[model samples]
Target: MLSNTIGETKTARNFFGIHLSLSSDMLRFDIYKEDGEVFEDLAYRALKIAVMATKRKQIRNLPGYYKGVLRKLIDETYFKDMFMYFDVPLGDFYFPENYEPS
Candidate 1:
C-alpha cells in the first residue's frame, strides 16, 4: 500500500499517531490516538477501579500525588498499572515487563 506520495493512507499511521483502521484480514483499529492518550485512559481507569474496590477506607484522589504518579508511568510500558489496578502486586509493580525504572 505504497504510493510514494503523502496523504496516501497507505498504512493508516503517521507521525502524529495511528488514527485509522485496517482491513479485517490484517488487523482492526478504529480509534484516533495521540502519544499518551492510551496511557492516560488506562491509568485513569485503573485508579478509578482501585478507588472503587477500596472498602476499608475512603480513597481520595489527591491531585498532587496521583497526577504525578500517573504521569510518571505513562509511556514506560504496557499494562504498567496492572498491579495497582487489580490490587494484586505480584512483587513486581515497580518493574513490569521490559520496563526499566527511571
Candidate 2:
C-alpha cells in the first residue's frame, strides 16, 4: 500500500521547484529527460498533457494531470523497462497565489 508520509514533503518541494521553472512553451520539446528513448517518450506525454490543459485554460489542473501521468508511468505493466526516478505529490503543482495569466 502507498504511504503518503514517505518522502512526501521532499517530493512536493521538488515538484514545486520544477513547476516554478517550467513555462507553457517548455512543453514543446522533450526537455524533462536527458537520455533514453523511453524517458523521452514519458516526457513528451507529460508535456502533451500540460499543453492540452493550458490550451483548455485549465492550467490549474496540471498537477492532477501530471500525477495521473506519473502514476501510469510508475506502473511496471505500463512500460516494459521504464521506472519512475522520483515522486511528486499532486498538491505541489498548484499555481502561485498571486499568479494571473496574461
State every prediction's TM-score relative to the real structure: 0.26, 0.32
Alpha-carbon RMSD, each predicted model: 16.8, 19.1
* Tens-place lDDT digits, model 1, residues 13-87: 331121111112112333323434565454554344444445555646333233344445442454466557786
| Ten-residue stretch with the least lDDT total in model 1 | 15-24
Candidate 2 positional error at 55, Å:
1.4
**Which structure among the candidates has the greatest TM-score?**
2
Worst 10 residues of 2 by lDDT: 1-10
Tens digits of per-residue lDDT for model 2, 1-98? 01142236664554444443442224445762433455445545664665566777755655566656544653433345543543666667779889
